[model samples]
Target: MSVFNQPRRRIVVLIILGLAMVLIARLSYLQIVEKKYQRLADANAVTKKIVYPSRGIIFDRKNRSILGNDILYDLVVTPAAVKNIDTSYLCEILEINKEEFIKRIGDAVKRNGRVRPSVFAGLLSAATFSRLQESMYLFQAGFELVQRPIRSYPYKAAANILGYIGEISPGMLKTDKYSDYQSGDYIGLTGLEKTYEDVLMGQRGTRYIIKDNLNRPQGALENGDFDTAAIAGKNLRLSLDIELQVLGEELMRNKIGSIVAIDPSTGGILAMVSGPVFDPNLLTGSSRTKNVSKLFVDPTEPFLNRGIQATYQPGSAMKPLTAIVALDEGLITPDFGFPCHGGYTSCKFIKCLHSEAGHAANLRAAMAHSCNSYFLHLYRMEVDDRKWGGVKKGHAKWKEYMSRFGLGHRLGIDIPGESPGIVADTTVLNKRYNGNWNSCSELYVGIGQGQVAVTPLQMANAMCLIANKGSYFLPHLVESIDLDSSDLLKKFKERHTVAKISDTAYHSVIYGMEDVIEHGTGRGAQMNGIAVCGKTGTAQNRGIVNGKAVDLKDHSVFVAFAPRDNPKIAIAVIVENAGTGATFAVPIANLMMEKYLRDTLPLSKQPIMKRMLETTTIQLSKLETSKIDSLNATTGMLTSEAILKKYFH
Candidate 1:
């Protein structure tokens, strides 16, 4: 009886020991080795906040702040944590009605689940933030304040050049280009802001904090061991001269036009003015969406970066390239003379403005007078030369020369939305004229009319080529990024050779341009002491009027470089529907040159400045209506008949 009872007792003791070991192992796994339960516990008791980095600042060539940073506050909401609070009182603090409060809560829920935070009201003023912060504790666990960096324009100028930032769209978030971005991140939408977004957008950081049972942050988790500090974006220095830019804008105000000024030495833009531009601050803060909507539908098209995006026929402003091409090809000498009988002999549609009897002229005289007949002769020589065999080959050669000059191409500017313009290559000419075009058929291109078009930027760059005597750097807005940045900005530092024209040819052409400002068509552009080499152009365009195609008055265009030799600035100015380059564009170009080269206008030119500022080329009614017919009909038709008669008659 004793032996059998001993064996059963040993077995029972063994089974109890095995069950005890299993229970100990399960408790150890849950308490120490497994992290899922601990993670779940932390999720309910910790808050992770994203820290946004400050955007980079922008400075002008003179080190003046063109764009700066300002601190703004956002009202953030966590829908799930909202409890029994005074909803009406909170809405009153936010200055929003009950309906808006409900809608924002719903939106916050839709954007991010109820547990996550979303922006309820963005870009609040300091006064409003102070009022709301005073009452913030009443809405604890449901509402909080987040600081955001917003752009501030101190000079209130260069809106088109600096651009604006806005929230990234849902479409952008889906694309590979913006893969690093999230739903509420801001991105540059245009101009330099868009081009240098990578360098300007600094690295964001994150911080973790312990929360209490009420879901309120108590303190940093683990003494801030997991917290990461935000890295501020790199600063940028621009090539623009803010004073010159301001002056250009003032002069071009109340007009529909653009002005582009470049440093021929560096190809860095000095001043770029697109008229009818709005205050850049309009696109910032609480009113941004509303203001953008207003601008989007505005008839004047203030959003268009006309300096780079708007294309015009370029008028006689294109003749300098023609002269250079002819001289470079050795088809014509500076001394080569053409007898102008008020028009091209082969093309009566092209008229000469110099004289009814016509001037027997050399290249310099033709350029000074902007003689259509003479340039027509030169254009024909370049495209119909016997050495090239035929119009097709000669035209191809001419097209090649144009391409080298940065015409009919993007020119690879750092800014976005630059137009290549119309070069009327062999393919385009074939399409337009059904392969029946010849040198004479496209002779209108010789005078900067017909299908040949250019932007103010391209025109200014062409003048840079002439000022540098056949070589140029690609035009760019940014001068330098911070030293630590790894960006593609170094690409702009390279030089480009447009042509191999002789110095002698340049001298001859320059002499003609000098005469142009001194005593010829561009005489209005003359400064008291500076010698400005300039050319005037009247580009022809057509528009529909009263449901019929009508001839619009030509666009006024002028291009120049001064003090002629060792030129400091190369510029192009275009005034739409403004008759004669001398009337509108020349004076503005002269004023801008004076302001930049001399730093101030002479007392004698004060009257001219006043007159320029007061002149209004755009009619208010037409701009307000924004109808296509109204825009087309009012443009180029606003020039006084007296001015038209003086130029055309």
Candidate 2:
């Protein structure tokens, strides 16, 4: 009792009181001043949301439509919010059975988080959605409809050129790089869609919105300040002219091959048609999934872009290029002719054809008559000459010419599956022959028979270069890009230069090419008042003969550009198994050119030609039979009656 009454005891009591007062004041500040922080935690826990943006448009050069816009609807589900989802009732509303409903819901639950929503089904029609909307509220986890822009092809041709968009794959979804895409997201699967995916598919937009207790969107979060507007995909105005494309497609109706047209000045792809084309609408909107599956499973490949993918030996078409190389290398002059004794001589093999009458004259006549013997002589003499150095040097120089003409390499065109054709390296030849390769080993290459191969696109572009007198543009389908709100694509339509040749060389080559249409194998492609310049090719292809290989058929090819004095359009046509260039390929090219320039062309006398392109479904049937017969010797399936109509009707 005496110690408590002392001055030290009184001071300790005062310090304890001050500490207790401070603790009480801090507790009051936390409960009253920081209470708003707790509301944010509650808001985040219950909110559920997603944003979808409009897809981009695809257009023709004039912004007239190639692939534009169409309606696409999807059925989406949120598993956590899906309560009271009367299985039988909901299924009936959505036109699905109970089993399907369960499967969809189960998939969504497994694939996505419990609170997050996922697409249950895709490509729904508007009529189906109307019925679904009536009882959609009954689904415990709510279902909603999202309208998306599906790809549409207005011209309905060019399916392989425009390509298609498809759903994202599960494997792709698993990759960290694809985190931006959901299961329902569409991707460019082929053609230009795949080639220019980045430019065509714009950046996705995003928005935030507050949700109520039921997880429904209340309104724009924070008054719309937190939204990202989706940038619409750039509209691709392809260099393709719709009218020209339609004419080409119509001309190739019953044929099994490809036609490619380019502008001499711009490398713009005016027309591209692969025969037996399935409708682009078949790959768009509601029909896309079912039709694409059918197309994929069909034996005949309607999806293959034959213009750039199919490699064919240039054949007689290579004659002009060979002549050019010879002239450029100073191996031959206009009058310094070679005697085509109907063949060429080599130590390893003697190369000759069925032709006994070879042109014994200048380069001009050899090209005019398409004399193979002339090319054989020139190749042997030039390659073996030491003036331009050794055989390797000659071959390299020849390769350079090929490259200049966009051969033995992939032309930078905007298409998928484009092959670089086939060019052999010296080392490769040396290895194959055990270090004893000769000029004679590659002798056939001079005539485009050995290892030289080119695509129809390359052939057309090469012709354009010659027509333009030595310069070319990078061949392109999309001539321009258009934004949604502007008429600014004009700036993008400028020409893109690829190469330039000398004027003298260009004019000389043009003269020889002009002679081809005037009095040569390519005479069939000549049009009235068009001044067409052209070259013809008949390439031997393999076939089965008495249990052995034989060159039983030929690929007919024709390359030309119209209005020889001032070329406007250049075209290449290839008809598979068509026997001769003049018979099949040249005629088609002529018809197309006339339709483009003069608008008056006659129809083919062959009944098969008339019927091959009756309708997409029917034509595809014939193509299927042809493909099946090509692949299997044992399959005894006859051509479909629908296809037989072409021959018998």
Task: Report how far off residue 243 is in candidate 2 (Å).
Answer: 2.0
Off by over 4 Å in 1: 1-41, 355-358, 485-487, 624-649
TM-score for all predictions? 0.89, 0.82
Q: In model 2, which runs have C-alpha deviations exceeding 4 angstroms? A: 1-49, 93-96, 174-179, 207-225, 341-360, 483-505, 543-552, 598-649
Best by TM-score: 1
Estimate the overall C-alpha local distance difference test score of candidate 1.
0.84
User: What would the C-alpha RMSD of candidate 1 be, to one decimal place?
Assistant: 7.4
The TM-score obtained by model 1 is 0.89
Clashing pairs in 1: 577-636
